[model samples]
Target: MTVTTQPDYRCTPSPLHAILLAGTVPLFLGALLSDIAYYNSFQIQWTNFAAWLIAGGLLFAGLALLFALANLIRADRKAGRPVMYLVLLLVTWVLGLVNAFEHAKDAWAVMPSGLVLSVIVSVLAVITAWLGLSNLRSGGAR
Candidate 1:
C-alpha cells in the first residue's frame, strides 16, 4: 500500500497588511485632530506635516493591500470574501485621500466632510483587517 500527503494550499495574510489596516484608524484620527488644530490656530505646525505623512502612508498602504488581495484571489479562486472587503477599503481610502488633500490645501470648509470620510475609512479598515486576519488564521477559504 502507498500513502500520499496532500500539500496545504492555504495562503497566509501579510503582516504588513495587518499593520496597515490596524494603523489606519489611529492615523486618520491623528490627521483629523491635526487638521482641526491647524484650522483653529491658523498656523502651520508639525501636526500638519504629520497628518499629510499619515494620509500619504495610508494611501500607499491601501493600494498595497488591494494588490495583495488581488494576488491572493488570483491564486485561490475560492477566496471571494476578501475582494469585497478590499473594495470597501479602497473606496474609503480614496475618500480619505480627498480629505487629506483638502486639508493640505488649507481648505477649512472641507474639514467637516473630511472628518466624516476619515471615520468611515477607519471603520472599513478595521473590518477589512479583521476579516483578512481571521481568514488567514482559519486556513483561508473553503
Candidate 2:
C-alpha cells in the first residue's frame, strides 16, 4: 500500500505584511491615549501628539489595507475569511481617515467628538490587526 497526503496551501501574510498589519494597533492606541490625556489635562500638546499618532496609524493601516487587497486577490476562492478581513481593513482605514479629519479641527473644537472617534477608531484598528494577523487561514483544508 502507498501512503499519500494532501498538501495544505495556507493563505497567510508575509512577515513584512504581518508587521504592517500589526503596526496599526499601537499607533491608534497611542492616539487614543493622547486623546484621553488631552481630555484630562486640557493640554494642547496632547492633541498635537494625538493628531501625529492618528496620521501614523492611518499610514500603517493604509499599507496594510493594500496588502490585504493583494492577499484577497491572491486567494484561490473569494468567499469567506479573505473577504471578511478585507472588509475589516477597509472599515478601519475609512474610520481612521474620518478621525484624522476630526482631529484637524481646533484644539478645543477637536475635543469630545475627536475623542469619541479616536476610541471607535482605535477599537476598529485593534480588531483589524487582530483579524489580519490571526490564524484565520484561507484556501486550506483541515
Would you estimate the TM-scores of all the predictions? 0.64, 0.90
What are the per-residue Cα lDDT tens digits for candidate 1 across 1-142?
A: 9997554454555677666666666666676666566557755663465457556647655765776666556664544555565666677677666766655644455456655665565566566666655654212334
Q: In angstroms, give how far residue 80 of model 1 lies from its true place.
A: 2.6
Runs of candidate 1 exceeding 4 Å displacement: 1-10, 35-50, 136-142
Which of the numbered candidates is closest to the native, going by highest lDDT? 2
Q: How far does residue 93 in candidate 2 sit from its true spot (Å)?
A: 0.5
The CA root-mean-square deviation of candidate 1, after full C-alpha superposition on the true structure, stands at 4.7
Cα distance off (Å), candidate 2, residue 38: 0.3
Model 2 Cα shift for residue 15 (angstroms): 0.8
Candidate 1, position 128, lDDT: 61
The C-alpha local distance difference test score for the whole of candidate 1 amounts to 0.60
